[model samples]
Target: METVRTRPGAGRQGGSGRRLTRRQAVGALVAEAGGSPLRRTMGVGQLTLLSVGATLGTGIFVVLGQAVPQAGPAIVVSFVLAGVTALFSALSYAELAGMIPGSGSSYSYAYATMGELIAWVCGWCLILEYGVSVAAVAVGWGQYVNELLRLTVGVTLPDALSAPPGAGGTLNVPAALIVVLAMAVLLRGAKESAVANTVMVTVKIAALVMFCAVAFTAFRAGNFQPLFPLGTAGMSAGAASLFFSYIGFDAASTAGEEARNPQRDLPRAIILSLVLVTALYVLVAVAALGAMPWRQFAGTEATLSEVLVRSVGGGNLWPVLLSVGAVVATTSVVLTVQYGQIRILFAMSRDGLVPPLFSKVHPTTGVPRANTVIVSAFIAVLAALVPLGSLADATSIGTLFAFMLVNLAVVLLRHRNPDAPRSFRVPFSPVTPVLGMGFCVYMLFSLGADTWIAFAAWMAAGLAVYGLYGIRHSKLDHGAGPQEGA
Candidate 1:
C-alpha cells in the first residue's frame, strides 16, 4: 500500500474565492481498506452480456420507430453515425476503466482528474443518465408487455393502464411492474442477476436474428429508394436520437469493483459489447427498412413485432413469438440498467455525495438493498407517468454530458499521470479523447431545446444538493485517511 497526499490547504478557496481545489487521489479511489464490499463475481463474458442486455432492447424494439420518422430509410446511416461517436468515447472509457478501476465509473474518474465540484456534477449527470434511462427502458418494456398480451390472450390492458398520460393512458402499470420485478432480482445477489441477464441476452439476440431471417425474406429494394427523404438535418437528428441506443456499452465500467479482473476484463467488455451492439443495431435497422416502408414506422410502438406481423401476414406464429422475445428483451434491459443505477448510487453514497443508505450493502447478498428499492421505486414512478420520448431525450443529453466528462478526464489523467499502469490505452491519446468530446458536443447541440432546458434544471438541482450536503460530508473534505491497495 502507498499513500499520496494532496497539496497543503487543497480544499480551501484561493484569493479570488472562486477556484476551489479538492481532488481525490486515483489510488485512494481504486483502493479499498481490505477489498471491495461488492462481490467480485463477474467475468469478461458476463460483463459483456450485462452491457448487451442493458443496450439491445430499448433502441431496436422502441426508439427505432421514433428515429425512423426523423431519418426516413437512412436510419441505418444514423445507427452507424451514433456507433462511431460511441466508439470514440468507448476508447476513452476503456482507458480510464483499466487505469482506475472503481464502481464510480466516470464520476470517480472526474474526481481523480478534475476536482470534487466537477466530480459531483459528473455524478449528478450519471444519476440522470442511469436513473432516467432505467425509467425510459422500463417504459419501452411496457409496450412489449402489451404486445405479448395482445398476441397470447387476445386482449390487452386499456390505455389508462398500459400507457403514460397524454400518450393515451393515465398510468403505465406494466412499466412500473417490470421495475419492481427487476428490483426483486437485484436483491437476490449480483451473480444471480448476471446469470439472469445472460439468459435474457441470449434470447434477445436469437430473437433479432430470427427477425432478420424472416424480415429479409420480405425485403424489397424499392423501399429504400429515397434514402434521405428527410435530408441531412433529419439524419443528424436521427443520429442524436439513436445515440441513446449506445448508452449501455460503458455500463461494464460501472462494475469496476465487482469485476473479477477489472484492469483487463472491464476494457475488453466495454469495447466488445459496443462492437456487438453496433453490429446488431445496424443489421436490425437494415432488415427493418428493407421489409417495411420508412414512413410506416413513424408512430409505431412495437415496431419489430409489427414488422414481423405485416411481413408474414397477421395470422402467423412469428409475430406472437417475436412479441414474447421482445418482452424478454425489454425485461433484461430494465434489469441490467437498473442494476447499473444502483451501483453508481452505491459508489456516490460511499463517498458521502448522496445519502448513506445507498452505500449500505446487505451482509448476506452483498447488495445495497435500500438503494435498490429506492431507485427502483423512483424509476417505476417515472416510467408510469412520463412519456418514453421525453425520458429518452433527457437520458441521452445527460449521458452525453457525462461521457464528454469521461473523455476530458482521460486527457487530464494522462497529462497528470503519464506513467500510470493501464491494461488498455486509447491509441491516439489526446486526439481520440478530443474527438470524443467534439462528437458529444455535436450530438448535444442536435438535441431539442426542451431537453437542454431540462438538463440545466437537473444540473441546478444537483448543485443545490451538493452545496447543502455533499460539500460538508465528502470523505475527502473530512480527511478520511488514505485507502489501501491501489
Candidate 2:
C-alpha cells in the first residue's frame, strides 16, 4: 500500500510548498493510491451493464415526451444526431480510460493532461453532472411511481407530496424517498449495488422491448407525415434535449479502479454500452413515432403509458404492466447515477482534492459509505425542492463542458506523449478529438439561455471553492512524491 498523507491525522501543509506539474500528477495517479486500493472485483460484463443501466433511464422515459413536440416525427432524426455527437466524445473517453485506469473519469484525465486547476474545475462540473442528474432522475421516478399507482390502484399521490415547490407542490416525498433507498443500496458495497443494477437493467430493457412490441402493432404510415414540420432548427433543439439520455454511458470509465481488467475491459465496456444504448434508443424512437402522431406526445408526463393504453385498448392490463416498468426504469437510473457520483468523490478525495470524508471506504463493504451518505443527503433535498426541467438542463451543460475537456485531454496527450502505452487509441487522432470538441461546443451553446447562466454561476462557485481550499490544500500542492518518498 502507498503510504501518503490521506488521513485527517496528516498535517494539512506538511510537505514542501509546490504545485504538481501535469506530468507529476499523472505519475502520482498511476503509481500510488492514497491508502489501500479499492477492491478489484468487477469484470467487463458488470461494468458494461452499469453503463447501460445508468444511461438508459430518465431520458427515454421522461424527456422523450418533451422532445417529440420539438421535432414532430423527426424526433427520430434528433435521436440519431445526439447519439452521433455522444459517440465522438465516448471514443475520446475510451482512449483515456484505457490509458489512465483511474476512478475520477474526465477529471482525472484533465489533471494528468491539463493541470490541477483545470482538473478541479472538471471535477466540479462532474458534481453538477452526476449529482444533479441523480436528483433529476429521482424526480422522474416519482412521477412514474404516481402514474403506476394511478393505473394499477386508481390512486394518485397528492400534489403536495408529488411535485417540487417550484412545480406547485410542498415537497416531492417520493423523489426524496427513492434517493434515500438508492443510497442505502450503495452503502451495502459495490458488488451488491452491481447486482441490484443488473436486475433493474433487465427490468428496464424488458420494459422498452414491450413498449416497442406493442407500439409496432399500431404502426400507421400516416403518423410520420410532415417529417420535418418544425425544420432544421427544431430538430437540432430536440437533439440537444435528447443528449441528456446519453449522459451516463461514461459511468463505465468511473469504475477503472475497481475493474478486474481495466486496460482491455474499460474500452470495450465504454464502446459496447454506447452501441447498445444508441441502438435501443433508435428503436424506441421509431416505434413511438410510428404508433401515434408526434404532436400528441408533447407535454405529457405518462407518455409511454398513454401510448400503450391507446394501442392495446385502455381497459386491458398492458398499460398497467408498462407503468410498473416505467417505475422500475427510472429507479434504476437513480441508483446507477448516484453510484457514479460517489465513486468520483472517492477518487477526488483520495487525491486530497476534496474533503477526506469522501474517501472513507467502509472496512467491511469496501465502499465509500461516507461519501454516499453526504451526496445522497444533498441530492435528496434537491429532488424534494427543485423543478425537474432546471435540473435536467443544468446536468446537460455540465456534461457537455466535461466532454469538451476530455476531448482536449486526448488531443494534448497525443501530442505530448506519443510513446505512452495506450490499450485503446482513438482512431484518426487529431481529427476525432477536434470534432469531439466542436460537437460539444455546439451542443453547449444549443442549450437554453437560463441553462448557460446557471452553468456560469456553478462554474463561478467552483472557482471560488478551488481558490479558497482545493488549490492550497491539494496533496499535489504539497509535493507529495510518488510513493510518498519514504
Candidate 3:
C-alpha cells in the first residue's frame, strides 16, 4: 500500500527520469502477491547451494587449463586476486540486496538509486553476463561429456558435433542439449531446481576434494619454481580471465523474490557463497599446480581429470570419477545461471523495460515458463555456435561492467538515503565501494583489445534497443509509475 509516482514527461531519451524509490521497489513484492507471484520457498541453505552450484563449475574444470598457461604456477595467486576483487563487489551486492530485495539484482538497485535508463543499461549488461556465461559453461560441459563417454564406452562424439564452429565442430550438440535439459528442470519450479542443484553441488564438491587428495600425493615442491615466468602482467591477465570463474557468487541476490526471508538470507548467502568458493578455488589450484608442470597445461582440456590420472597413474579410476563430477558440476551451473537470467528479465518486464510475456508466471508452477523456454533456446543456439574462449571473455567484460555499476549504485544510494534501513551495510561506506569500482576498472583494462571492441558493439546494440522500444514502452512514461501486481 505504498504510493507510486509517475513523471509526466519522463519518456525523454538519455535522461535519468522515472526512478523508483527504494520503498516503491520493495513494495512491488507485496503488490505482486495478488498477481502471479513467485513462490517464496527457498531458504538460506538453498540460496547458498544455488550460488555455489552456479559458481563451482566451468572455471576450475575447464578454464584452469586456459588460465594456468598465462600465469604459470603463480596462477594460484591469480585465483586469489580475482577472489579479492569479487569480494568487494559481493559486499556491495549484499548491502543493496538486503535493502532492496528484488529479482533484478543490480538492475533493480540501479532503478532505485539511478533511473530507468541506467537500469535498462544494467539489465542489458546482465543479459550478456548470465546468458553468455551459461553458453560458455555449456561448451565446457561438452568436453567433459566427451571424456565421460570415452572412459565408459571407448567412444566420443565426432568433432563436428561435439565442438563449436571455430573449434573444429559444426555445432556443439552436447552443449546445446545440456541447456535444453536445464530448461526442462527450470520449467518444473524453483524449489525443484534448488533440490536438483543441491545434489549436484554436493557431487562436485566431493569430486574436487577427491582430486585434492590424489593430487597432493604427487605434490612437487620444485614445480613452484619460476612462478613469475610470465611476469606481473601475465599474472594480471590471468586474474582477468579467472574473474569469469567468480561471476556466479552473487547468484543468490537474483533469488530475492523467491527467498523465504530475503532481507536476512540474501546477504548471508552472498557473502558465504563467495568465501566458500574462493577457498575451494585456491585449494584446487594449488593441488593441480603441485601435481603437474604449468607449461603442460597449455593445450589441455579436462585438466583436473588429466591431473588426477597423471598423478595416480593411467590404470586408476580417479579420472573417470572426476569426469562424472564435472558433468554434474557443469549441469548445475547451466541450471542456476539460466534461472538467474530469467529472473532478471522477469524484473525488467515488470518495469516495462522488456516484453510483458517475460513476467508472466504460470499459476501452477509459479515460474515464468515462456521466459525460461525462450531464453534457454537462445542460449542453446549460442552454445552450439560459439567457441568457449570467446564466450568467456565476452561474459567477463559484461559482468565487470555490470559490477562496476552495482558498486556505484551502493555509494549513490547511501548518499541519497543515509538513514535507510539496511540489514547489511558495507564497512567504510564510499571507500569500499570506490575500491570496488577501481578493481573492476583494472580488470576491465586487463582484457584484450578485441574484447573491448566486442563489448563496445554490444553496448551500442543495447542502446539502440532502449531507444527504439524500452524508452517508449517504459511504465514510468505512461503515468502509471512501475507496474504493480496483475
Q: In angstroms, how far off is 225's CA in candidate 1?
A: 4.7
> Could you tell which candidate, 1 or 3, scores higher by lDDT?
3
Candidate 3 ranges with C-alpha deviation above 4 Å: 1-4, 7-36, 69-73, 164-168, 225-237, 293-302, 314-316, 386-392, 482-486
Error of 1 at 381 (Å): 3.1
Greater lDDT among 1 and 2 belongs to 1
Model 1, 201: alpha-carbon shift in Å? 0.7
| Stronger candidate by TM-score (1 vs 3) | 1
Tell me the lDDT of model 1 at 341: 85
TM-score of candidate 1 on Cα atoms, chains taken together: 0.91
- The TM-score values for the models, in the order shown, are 0.91, 0.91, 0.90
Q: Candidate 2, residues 1-486: lDDT per residue as tens digits? A: 233543442333444222433323455666553234577888999999999988988567666688988888888889899899899999999999988888899988988777676788889999999999889878878887887788778899999998988898999999999999999998887888889989999998998898899889999888888889999889988888888778888998888888888889999999999999989998988888888778778767536767767665757377677767778888888888898898898888877778899988788888887889999999999899988575567888888889999999999889776777899999998999899999999887777898888888889998898777776667655555432321
Q: Which TM-score value belongs to model 2?
A: 0.91
